[model samples]
Target chain A: MDVRFSPEQQALRDSAAQAVDRLGPHTVRDLEDTERAAKLDAAVEASGWRELRAAGEGRAPLASAVEAAIIAEEMGRGLADAPFVGATLAAELRRLVGAPPATARETVGFVADLSAPAVADRGTLPAGAVAIDARHSASALVLVPVEGGHAVAEVSLDASIPAEVDLTRPAATIAAGAGMERLGPVEQPLTADDLRRWTALGLGLTSADLVGVMRGVLSVACEYAGARRQYGVAIGSFQAVQHMLADACVAMEGSRSVALHAAWAVDALAAEEALAATAMAKAYCSRAARMVCETGIQVHGGIGNTWDCMAHVYLRRALLAIDVLGGAGANLQRVLDHNGIGGADGLR
Target chain B: MDFGDSPEEADFRRRLRDWLRDNNPGLPASSTSDAYWAGQAPWHQALYDAGFFGMSWPKDIGGQGLPSVYEVIVDAELARAGAPPRPSLGYLVVGIGHHASDDVKQRFLPGLVNGRDRWCQGFSEPDAGSDLASLRTRAELDGDEYVITGHKVWTSYSDAADWCLLLARTDPDVPKHRGLSAFAVPMRQPGIEQRPLKMINGVTREFGEVLFDGARVPAANMIGQPGEGWRLAMTVVSHEREPGELGYVARYSKVVSELGRQVKADPGKFGPEQVRDLGWAMIEAEMLRLHVSRRLSDRMDGISHGPEGSVDKLLMTAVEQAVGHAALSVGGTPHGDGDDMWLKVYLYSRAQSVMGGTSQIQRNLVASRILGLPAS
Candidate 1:
């Protein structure tokens, strides 16, 4: 068995990394700048990264979930203020619903109840209006409950976009009101397997993003420790700092391994196994990434707490990523549910 | 990348499984008893006759010349079948088989492979457990023999072993690590005395202390050149620490399954916390299996064992302890009475962190070696 990527996959990853590298180091200023976010989105679109999950003529898909995850991780490491995850998920949902391809400059936002479905705040406009990154999106693929299953509602995001904790990616609440166009209750009503597959894809990409954030933050922290001196020696020379960084490294590496496996499972394993793996990856990465980012800030000393440094940006992205799809507890509960430990009677 | 076995590997696994099913040796009544060794010898002989022993060693030295993955498969399958814990002569095989002279290999390796001899390692001293280089055991050469006078503790199977891989300082004036040497000493000598050290789990004579009052070993018995003991010992220890080699995942899988059965048997007795702990233990065990699989893949691709092995070691310790703790909590107070099996296991699991290397030392290794952090 081999764990290393093939040459073609490696090449794809390298090109993706190179494209995101052009964005340069993410700064506090980039967070609020809509122009920079738009620029980053355009660059990613030009790289054909947003179309990674799209199906082509008779081929299974142009790229596998593993490939999509690789690009997601790169975007995360760069902290690029692009709607990469949203756009990718939107393409996937659109494909599942047999919708036409999105226009060149038009980004597609995605919003669904990643956990259990409930009534979509009935009084709210467009009914269940969930917030998603829609800074540059013309519309969103919003999941709304139909009779038997969820349906994709193409809702306009022009009226409801708002700021989020993850400043790099703007969010907006979408509802099926007058301006929105309703899609299927698809030709085949969305099955539980379909929802699970979607959840697995979402978890894979989110966990990859978390893995990238932790690695990026840890690298910055280690460099800072090496350069920053207090008692006539690098702080990294001190045991406390060394141990902190070491623990972060271990956590990040473990998270990356699990995330990559989950991403591969999305395309390779049976539906149930894939769901379980996705839950496990999301649960582990959610906790690991937060710990690493927190330790990253700690390793940077006083400067880490400031708005100017990139440490808090990584932490913020990590915090935002954990909330996406679900937090650690939610995913862990999913793990237990999928592992047959749910319900009052054990071994359901 | 693929995680499942290749067709050849699958076939090999199937064949080994069938062999094990047919020639299954039931569990020994007692590990420290002479009857246990008597039963084990034939088992080892059958494995050797089947060409399973030394599958990863070179063909020139009577091995099958397969990749290390084959050996790993054997280990995994053995654990999967719930086979009795076979006597492990791998340390001696690796030490003498890899580094010893051709003469030494011909003399000892065949007996080891054929189960005619059992071997134990003598590296730790009472005062030098973690700080092994500080061991004061000394060996003085006179004529063609080295007279060893030292104390070795935590020597497993010392009573049953026919020989030992012992480490002693040959040049005291030199640096601690540089002055040591390794030798293959016969265990039946009158100069050597073994005193059983009862373990915390109340397992009597599971391991022991070997007192050497000038135990003599031939000069040619040295595995490597004099003062090369440190390097040799490190090689063996690294092998011991190697991920995926020990089949811990398979063993833990059984323990976890049994725990699940117990929980299922008495569902009303457990709380949410206990169930959650059990869930975490299972997750950790699965993660350990995955980690080991990835490491095996890496090894097959010619990656040398490195600090990443410490990652598996740390996880093993964590999973073992977690499962043990869950057993105790689920079994309730006075854990020893109703579930004495789990109680013994829990007691033994405490040594997981201490053996091989402490979790703290492993973290330091990861820091300095893998992360390139400054040593503290």
Candidate 2:
């Protein structure tokens, strides 16, 4: 019944936190714009993070979920241009698709076909199968081969990468070569359990980052409020400022808890359990982060809105996080679908 | 992490279901009003007399003393049986039976458990809903008694309540939150007035407002130390909401299944995404139920309810609201019994996020307490 992070897990989170702190958000931002899509190989190789990616194949999915969460949080906090999309997501997918060759590095794709390709069997092929565009050289078109392609894995564009505000981790449109040809039929679409695991991993990382961003925003707001005077007294002394800061504090904590719970669920429970918790975490924390950080900018008033102000960084990151991993609405729909609740009125 | 209830719980649920099926005095369908508060007091008392109410309260306090989860079980059964809700604030908020002082507990608890008296909370005011500490309702000491004067709003069933577990400010200047006290004031006492407050469903008055123009009550009526009103109120507020998305999930599942049938019956009645929406909500229900059950279990084992409660509140509210809207969408013109149910749920569901705590407050709780983030 009790849920507390194991000392080892706590250590893992702390380590990630420390690393991000040392690297700092500015350094990460710098790296993002300069390196963009090319940073993935270098980032993975330099941080010894490649080992973490490799470990997922042999480790428990829960353990991988936890580690991913920790790393994501750190990266999010630092706003680091690390390849979370390629490394974390690809790692999990590889595990689900079963172990791949050591030389293989997996990346997912979503094809948008304006013209519905005439298939030999419309009844047999799954609805959402589009071609995989190559952002990375190693990227490939993935098919879970179900009902002989009549029904298949639900796929969408992985926006966490190239669409990232930080250009370093920009999602590259990779070309699919031999990997594109290796398609198989999926008997079961990505299960609720699998989505839960991936989602837990996504939420944990995102929440941690959101918390970090909020912390940065709050620090800046507090400083300005203390130094900025109104009616000859520090603005920080004002009740309005205090209340705003307090609210931000609350939001930051909420995001943190969601991330922690999501991580814990992924590690301790089945994938479906993890998915639900993660979805809750993602939905709540993202909205909270936006509110808290926006307030941070508001408290700073004119100063916070400047391009140079770090508050905007937090704001941008929050926006990116919401869309990166499918957004709150999408995850919620996933939850509903998994439970066998269909028809327009069923959810009500 | 294990969200499923124990086998014993399953068996107990089954027994409860079977018993209700055999013995439930089913209410006439037309009699089930939105403000359906119409059971005989003695009939309500009979359950506690037979040891059915307060299953988790201490045995010394006239309960079965089972695990807290059993209370959830009992609530589920009661709702399923469509039995009238027993007057609860007296037992749930005030101590059941002899838990309060011998005289106080004995006088009020038995009456409440046995349904002779109904209780309503007297906490919120004009300025205090989510920000409850700002309430200006005052009660000054008058020798061995306290004279209370203030207005209370959003008191559920206050008009019908025989007693109120009320909070009043005893000192105005010390601090905004401190110097407040809680008293169990008899609603029928002098200088007390109650008026009904309409809910979204205009047909029902499930709540009311109470005004006290110098209402006086004995000093012994206080629940705890004089200045401990904040703590007492805090404890009670946290307990007001809990897990049971299972019922909502079940209800939503029924909606989705029925929709599939309806749509299949009439192709033009539902859109394509409408069917998906129902399915998605059902999936989410299962997911939310699992997470919420795990959280409840964690809390029952003495762990902090943590930010997980906020997460559950947020998800549950979204599901309830979404399901409500979905039902309305599918029901088309909002007519007939289905539309009526849809409208009632849609209106009530709005409170899911705001009632226990606002979604905004929940987000703040998560951000500050759980994450090591600075207060923004």
Candidate 3:
């Protein structure tokens, strides 16, 4: 068995990294700047990053989960204020159930599960929200539970929703009586297998994002440790600081390894196997990403605690990311349930 | 990028699995027992006769000379079948086979391959556990022989070994690292004494300490030139840490599956926290498995071992300890005879962090060597 990426894939990843680098660092001010968000969205779409999973002349939809993960990781590393994750998930759903394509320039948001579908059925919907890059999203593709499986629904998010802890990606809570359009499953409805595949893709991509976040934060902390000297030597020369940064590196690499495996499995393995692998990847990466970010802050000393530093940016994003599909406990429960060791009570 | 076995590897694995099924020797009562060693001797011989022993060794040294992947398959299959571990002498043979003189290789490789001779390492002394270069073992050349005198502790299987890869100080005036030398000394001498050191488990005598008042060995038994012990010892330690030889992934997979079986057999025995802990252990084991597999793949692709081996070693310790803890937590209170297995595993797992370089040393290695952090 081999685990090294091909030279071509490496080249693709390098280009993605370059694109994210060109966007510059994401700060708190940029989170609230609509003009900067629009510019970033235009740049992302112009780079064809949004269409990575869309089918072309000779390619299938989402040709390589590994390539998609590479792009997602770069976006996460740059902390780009764009809806790439949701857009890609929407593209995947369209490919799976034959839904209409999203507009060329319009960003799409995604929700894997709709917690309060009853609010949607009622004429007046409460402020129902899901965490996505909703600042510029035109519509949201959400999965609602049906009798046997799940159905896809598109909801317009023209109504405003306040930002959450992760200011970069705002939660667009839908207002009452907003336009809601049901899509997909019109011909062949999604089955249990489709839901499993969707969950696998979601977990794989999210884990990749966590890997990127951890790596980015760790890189920053390591650089700071080397340059921020005290007592006539770099603090990195001290075992206390060196050990913390080293642990962060290990956690990031471990998350990357498992996330890459899960991403590959999403495309290569069967439904059950892919789901199990994704569960494992998410379970490990969720906690690892948090530890890496927390340690990154600690390594930076007092300056790391300030909002201006990028450490909080990474930590905030990681905290929000881990809760997107589920937390570590929930994913771990999925693993146990898949293994037939426990009931599926905690799995969403 | 792929984790599945190739066609040839798949076939080899299938054949090995069949052979094991037909000739399965269940787990021995105790690894330190004479019967266990007696059983392992023939088992290793059978493996050698079947062309599975020296798959990665050079052809000039009476080996199959195959790629390292075949050896990995053999190891994986052995673990999957719960077969006895390979003889400890095999490790020394691999090291000496590669770095020793032609005379040394010819004299030792055959006996080691056939299980006629058992070997143990004498690198760690009571005062030189982690700082092996500071070992006080002395070997002075007198005429055509070298007289060795020192004490070695935590030497596994020394009681059953016929020979030892001993390290000693040859030049006291030089630096700690440069003055050392390595030798292949016969263990059946009057000056050498081995006393079994019972481990924390209270039932195993697999480890012991060896004392040498004044043991004599021919000068020709030196594996390399004088003052080359440090380099040779590094080689031996690297070989010890190499992936795929121990089939650790398959072994961990077995442990995790057994834990899952126990949990499933009685779901009410554990609380939600314990169940979650069990699931986390399974994930950790899988992560360790994948990490090691990636290392093995890199080796097959011609990438040599580096600081990444330390990463795998650290993960190995973590997963082993996690699994042991989970098993104990789920087993709850032990009822005398029924909980012996869990108690033994829990006690043994404590050593995972201590043995083969402590977890602290591993972190230091990764920090300085792999991460490029300045040494502290």
Off by over 4 Å in 3: A26-43, A56-59, A105-127, A144-148, A159-163, A184-187, A344-348, B28-40, B51-94, B109-116, B242-245, B333-337
Q: Model 3: per-residue lDDT, tens digit, A253-276?
A: 778778988988887888889989
lDDT of 3 by residue, B55-135 (tens): 766766656776665665675676667676545444576668656889888887777766667777898999998899999
Q: DockQ for all models, in order?
A: 0.44, 0.09, 0.57
TM-score of each: 0.89, 0.66, 0.91
Q: By DockQ, who's the top model here?
A: 3
Which lDDT tens digits does candidate 1 get at residues B1-376? 7655789889989998998898868643232133444566677778888877777666766678776666657766776676654455565677676677888788888777677787788999999988989999889999999999999999977877889899999999988999999988999998999987887766654578999998899999988889989988877776666546555665566566667667667668777777776776666666666666667666666787678767667767877887778666665546344636566667777887887778777777777787676655
Weakest 10 consecutive residues of candidate 1 chain B by summed lDDT: B28-37
Off by over 4 Å in 1: A30-39, A104-128, A145-149, A158-163, A175-187, A342-348, B16-55, B60-64, B67-98, B110-116, B333-336
lDDT, residue B201, model 2:
48
Question: What does the lDDT read for residue B233 in candidate 3?
Answer: 80
lDDT of 1 at A329: 74
Of the candidates shown, which would achieve the greatest TM-score relative to the real structure?
3
| CAPRI class of candidate 2 | incorrect
